[model samples]
Target: MDNDFSVDLDDILATLRSHDIVIARFVTVHRRLLFDFRSTPLDPPLVAAVDPLPSIEARYRHLRELRPRLGDPPKLVTVFWPRFVASLADTPAWQAVRGRLSASGHPGAVESADAALAGLVDLERAAQREAILGGRAFRTIWSASPSPR
Candidate 1:
C-alpha cells in the first residue's frame, strides 16, 4: 500500500498570508511529524504543520520562482523545528532571526515565507508607499515604551 500524507496548499497559503507563520501537522503510514518554518521565510512553515514532504518540496520550488519576480530578494530566511521547542525558546534564535530579517533590507521585503503566497503583497504595499512619497522614501516609526515582560 502507498503510505503518504496530503496537505491543503490553499489553507497553508492562507495561513501564511494572514499570520506570517504556520505550524502544521503531518501523518504518514508509520508516524506523525511537524513542519516548522521559523527559519527561512522562503520555505513554508511545515516543520510542525502536517504536510507531505513532497508537497513541501513542490511549494518551495514554486516560491523560489515567485520571490524575485516580486522585487528585491529578502534578507533573512529561517526554519524552526517543533521538536526542539525548548531549545528554541531558551536561545536567542527568534530575536536573532528577527534581527537578521530587520537588517536584510527594508521591512517591505521582509515577509515570512507563508505570507509570500498572497501574490506579491509586499510589492503592492511598497508601490503604495512609493506612490504617496514619489519614491522609496519610507521608514518604520515607533514610540518609545518600556519592554513588556
Candidate 2:
C-alpha cells in the first residue's frame, strides 16, 4: 500500500457505523459494477475510480443528506493503483469527471482533493515500477500528470 494513498479502513468503518451506514466490500472486475453496488457482492461501498458525475453526484448527495441523520460524515474508502490510467482512459465518464475535478479552482476542497489524488497516482506509479523490477505480478499504476488547465 502506498503511504500517500493511505486510508484508514477501520476509521472509515467507525465513521460509517456512527452514521448508521453499512459498509460492504465486493470484488469484481467490471466498470459497470460501479453503477449499482447492490448488484455486486460487496457489502461496504468501495471507491475504485472517481468517474461518472451523475452517479457520483447522486451518491454524494445521498451521503451528504444522510450525514445529519447519522450525526457523522459518510465514510468512503477507495484504493487505486497504476493501471488506473488505462482503465480510466477507456472510460468516457471517468475522463469527464477527471476533467471537471482538474479544472476546479484552487483554494478550495476540490483543489485539495485533486492534489491528494494526484499524489496518490504518483505513489502508485512508483510502487508499480518497483514491482516490475522485482519480477512481481503487474501492479496497478497511476500516471500522475498535472492538469494543463
Candidate 3:
C-alpha cells in the first residue's frame, strides 16, 4: 500500500509571492552606501559627518596593526569603547602602553598608536552619523569593529 499526499500549489505560490514582495521592499528602502565615504556630491551635513573621518575599515585595520598586543579587532574595539566614555585621547590603556613603548625608545610608535586610536573614534562617529541619516536606529559596528572585508 502507498500513501498519497495532497499538494497546495496555490498556498505555495502565495507564500513565494509574499517573500518576493518583502525582498522588493527591502531593496528599495534599505539602500547601503556603496563606499564608506560618498563619491558623488552629497548633502552638506552628510559630507561633514563622513568626510572628516578616515575610512572605517582601513582605520580599524591600522589600529589593530598598531596595537596587536590588544588582541583581535573585535576584542580591541570592545576594550576601547568603554575607555572612550570620558575621553578619546586619555584612555588609561593608551597611557600605560605609551609609557612602556616610550621607555623602550621605539620612535614614532607612541605617536602612531595615538593617531590610530583618535582615528578609530572618528570612524565610530562617522558610522553613527551615517546610521542616523539612513534612519537606522541600530547598527552592527557601533563598537567601531570595522568589517574584516
Best by lDDT: 2
Over 46-122, each residue of candidate 1 has an lDDT whose tens digit, in order, gives 22212243565554554454343333223222232333222222334334333444544434333552233222334
TM-score, model 3 to reference = 0.35
lDDT for each residue of candidate 3 in 13-75, tens digit (9 for 90 to 100): 343222211100111112111111111122110101112124556545644453444433332
CA shift at 14, candidate 2, in angstroms? 24
- The TM-scores of all predictions, comma-separated, are 0.27, 0.29, 0.35
Better of 1 and 2 by TM-score: 2
Q: How far in Å is the alpha carbon of 33 misplaced in model 1?
A: 14
Total clashing residue pairs per candidate? Answer: 24, 13, 0
TM-score of 2: 0.29
Runs in model 1 deviating more than 4 A are 1-57, 65-90, 108-149
Judged by whole-model lDDT over C-alpha atoms, candidate 2 comes out at 0.36
Query: What stretches of model 2 exceed 4 Å from their correct place?
Result: 1-70, 74-106, 135-149
lDDT of 2 by residue, 15-62 (tens): 333332232221221121121111112222222323323554565675
lDDT of each: 0.35, 0.36, 0.33
lDDT of 2 at 52: 26
